[model samples]
Each structure stands twice: as C-alpha cells, then as structure tokens.
Target: MRASRPVELVCPAGSLPALRAAVDEGADAVYLGFRDATNARNFPGLNFDRDEAAEGIAYARERGSRVFVALNTFPQPGGWRRWTETLALAADLGVDAVIAADAGLLRHAARHHPDLILHLSVQGSATNRAALTLYHEQFGIRRAVLPRVLSLTQVERLIDNVPVELEVFGFGSLCVMVEGRCVLSSFITGRSPNSCGVCSPAEAVRWEETPAGRQVRLGGVLTDCYRPGEPAGYPTLCKGRFRVNDITYYAIEEPTSLNVLDILPALVRAGVAAVKVEGRQRSPAYVREVTRVLRAALDACQADPDGYRPDPEWTGALDRLSEGQTHTLGALHRPWQ
Candidate 1:
C-alpha cells in the first residue's frame, strides 16, 4: 500500500441537528444537500432548506468543521436550472467545497465560480486513475470521491497515478450496484437514480404479513420474504433476495453495513485523502456516536501508526447502531462474495 498521512473524516449531515452533532463529535467536514432533487438523498422531510443550510454551515465553520454541499445528481432535461441555481447558492453560502457529478454542472461551476473547490462525487463513477485525472485536468476538481467498487490495492494504484485528492467510502451502507451505474430502481419505477436523485423512493416500499411470515416488496416486486424469526431489513432492491439459475440468492448484495473501524490503518496507508461515512437518513445520535468513535480511532492512528489499534468498544458501538442484520468490509478488501 502507498502510505500517506491520516485521512480527513468527511461525514454526512442530512439535518441541522445531525450537522451540529457531527461537528461536536469531531467530524473534520460535513457533506449535506438541500431538500430538493439537486441532491441524491432527496427524501421527504430530510435535507436542509436555504436558511437551515446557511445556519448549519455557520455552525460547522465556527467549530472548525468544513462544509461540503452535494449537488451530485444529474439534472433533468428541463430542470437543469434548479441544479445550476443550487450550485450558485452553495457558493454564495461559502461552503468549503461543492460535490458535483454532472459534467455540464461541473463546467458551469468551473466557469462561473473559478475559485469554488469542486469534489467529484462517486456518482460520477470515477473509478480509475485516468478518469479521475481527466476530471481534475478538465474541471479543476481538487478531489474525487471514488466509486465503492475498487479494492484497496486498486485504490492505492489510482491514488498513486491521479493528481487530485481521493475520498473513499470508509463506513456506510454498501450499494451493490456500481456507483453512478445503477438503474434497478429506475427500471421498476419511473424515477431515475441519476436524474431523479433517488434509488428506491421510500414511498414505493410495501410490507405485509404472508403465510410464510412477512413479505417485503419494492415497486410491487417481492424483495424478500422472511420467516417468522428472521430479522427484517429495509426493502431496497439491491439488498433484496432474488433468484438466478434456479437458486435463490442475493443477486446484488445481502443486507449489510460497511464497518471499517478495524481497517483504519490499512486505509490510511493506502493514500486515501478522506474517509466518508454514509448515513444521511440516520439520526443525529447515530452521527454523534459514529463520529466520536471514528474520530478517536483516526486520532490514535495519527499518534502512532505502528502502535495503533482501534478500540474494540467503539467498533462494537458502531455495529450496535448499524442497520440490517450484519456488517462487512464489502468491496474494499476484495470483491463482494
């Protein structure tokens, strides 16, 4: 692995309280979105409004935490105006950076706000060094949020070759599909993940009691039918059980969280610039707990790379707070098995 300094902890803040909690618990930076289609996490009753966003930015800045606004989703044909306007507003708010995926919007930001720092979102699927370098060369993107599909070795290679900074998903819910390449949600519903800013819209989920036990469905497709004693997980299409070759299996990914607390040192040595925590829909309490634990772990690693070992208690704490029935390193170590 290509070793580097300790990586920055860039966490998610879906709401004002979560923003405050993240900063207080020791997040170096917080990434959030406006409550609109311009952001990928465009769920109802989530995300910040203009006033709330400004307040959250100020709150984070006062506590020495940087704020990055996500303008990651591709714009709809006639709805390009909304994304453009949101970018302008984010720049006006003095956010430390803006996470963007669309090429056109990146061009607009590069032209209009030359000094505004741009971080390429993983939604752009910049997996390789060539693609990452191209974005940096063309749009002056300072950092790239790499797709989750790359292994640690691959990330080390990309980091070695790419000129821009690299951010990887350190801990989060693993999306089975390649980042920026998933169309499963859109195939079932009219909404497109890239353009509509949602994968499986919450409104499309359905659950009911069945003769076997409980059946969970998404967009009228049976996702998983659980026995009476089995733990029920959220019905996202990727994590749902499906059949292939006459054998029922999890076609995409099993319902699992990505908890990489133990692998902090390995990731730090892999030339990663930032470590992202992916839970915009989680509670502020979850933000606080996870941030506090990871912050300490990173601090320990920075203090003594050779002597560092993540606290077993903190790892347990994160696992307890995680959703689904299990957690794993996902594709970071190897291909999802």
Candidate 2:
C-alpha cells in the first residue's frame, strides 16, 4: 500500500439511479442535493426528496461509499429557516458531510451539530488561505471545494497553507463567472441562481425556428442563433453571443467543459483530499461514465503517480460527454496573468 492515502473520487448523483451507478462504478463518495432552493442545482425535476436521499445514503454506505448533502445555496432574507431545517435533515439522513456556502449556515452547522462534517462549497468562493483559515477557525470546516478560477499553482500554494482538506473540480461545465456571484440570469429572468438554484431557468427559455436559423432566447432576449446545420446549445446569458462594435461574438464566454485528466497525478501528489465532478443536473449515464473513467484514472495515479498516463479510451469517453465536445484546463493552466 502507498504510505499516503489515495485521493478520494467524488462523483455527482442527480437521482437515486445516478447514486447507485456512481457507487457501483467505484466512486469513493457521491454528492447530491435536496429538491429545493437549499441546493444550487434546483431544476424542475432534479435532486432528491427525503426518502430518496435516505435510500441513496443507505446504498452508498452499504457499498463503502460516502454521501454528501449539498446545502450549498445562499438563503434569502426570510428563508434562513429552510437552510437550518435542511441541515437538520442532512444530519437525520446520516450523510457523511454537509456542503454549504452561507456563513450563517456554516456557523449553525458548527454550533448546533458539532459532529457533522462541514465542507465549504465552491460557491463559498474561498480562494485564499486566509479565507480558509477564517472558515476553519469559525465554522470547523473539514473540507473546502476550490472555485474553478484558481490556477494549478495557486491550488498547490493553498494546500500548503490551509489546515483543512481541499477539493477541486476535475470535470464538468465551466462557469464563466465566479462561483457564487453571478446575477446575469436573475437580471433577465428574475430568478436568482444563488438562492433560486438555476441560471436561465427552463421556463424562461424559448426556442423558435426562423428563416435565418434556429434561435434561443432567455426571458425573450435572444441568447443565441444557430445555422440550420449547427448545434444549438442551451440558452444562458453568459454563453450567449452578442453584437459588439459591429462584430458578433461570444462576449462573456463560449460554451466548454473543464477536464483535468492530464493533471490527475499532479493533483494527487499535491495532497488534494478529493476530486469532485460537477453536474448534478446531468443524467445517470453521465454520472456512470464519468465516475468510471475518473475512478480508473485515479486508481492508476494512486498506484503509480510518476508513471501515470491518461488512457486514450478514458479521454474518448469523457470527450463524448463534454459540453460542446470541447474541453479546457480552465484557469488551472494560466497563460500569463
């Protein structure tokens, strides 16, 4: 056995079937959320109810995999009780950890349920060691998920400084904005992604076929227009093409996914406790295939970090599932900054 423990493989579970697929595919842990605004991915038909969460947790535990409940969204002015009650529900469900972003929610979790393992969500946006220290000292957080904005060098530096465990995103959709602060969707749809749990929510999205091409609009504002043969992506404010200076281009960000298979060894060697896969909004097949590939890559890295190489088959599988059929290191590999 290696002297150090292997980095954990954390997977996403949008439903009970996804939870089972993850555990069966070799995930060390799976993270999910309740079907409410308390979690970030509050889509129309996603997330778990109380009984489903209980069953998922039970299934994971039976297979030696852990379950984390994401109460990761900020509670609105008068909605604080829902946050607290969900934390209570997490404890009652016997989940392994509670991932949260709100200061008050973390404080309550620390004070009221001292034994509960608190994980600072990526939405917490704690980029530096100082912020990690504050949360560790005040809220007793055991792990903190890093926002996707940090470069690989920054992540290594933070790991050397923080007292708590660190988790980083290894795969999934790339958010152009900082994790918890985007208000673009709310500005257009009047539904806050931070508290209401969706960006460019489904109801506000409209698709219509025009003679020029197929166009998609968010809250009646044209987000994107695609040629007849081109692929039409989901309409989101950030990923939309806008006309600026008489030139049409993706002003904010083009649609892409983050894939870190090439750097799995570097992260494993750098003392990261867990590698998280984003997308509780995806399907069970998505959860299964991603978990399968990452599990294989992680196991290989653990066995021999220096000699580890990402398998071609693994790369192909992830590429097929990637958003826009393209991938980037995201901010992990910086140009100059």
TM-score to native of every candidate shown: 0.96, 0.97
Q: Model 2, which residues run further than 4 Å from truth?
A: 1-4
Candidate 2 residue-wise lDDT at 244: 96
lDDT of each residue in 215-302, candidate 2, tens digit only:
9989999989999888767787888899999999988877878899999988988889999999889999999999999999999998
Candidate 2 lDDT? 0.89
Q: Residue 243 lDDT in model 2? A: 96
**Highest-scoring model, lDDT:** 2
Q: Model 1, 162-219: lDDT tens per residue?
A: 8888988877788766788988888887676687888888888898997977998788
TM-score of 1: 0.96
Which residues of candidate 1, in runs, are more than 4 Å off?
Answer: 1-6, 335-337
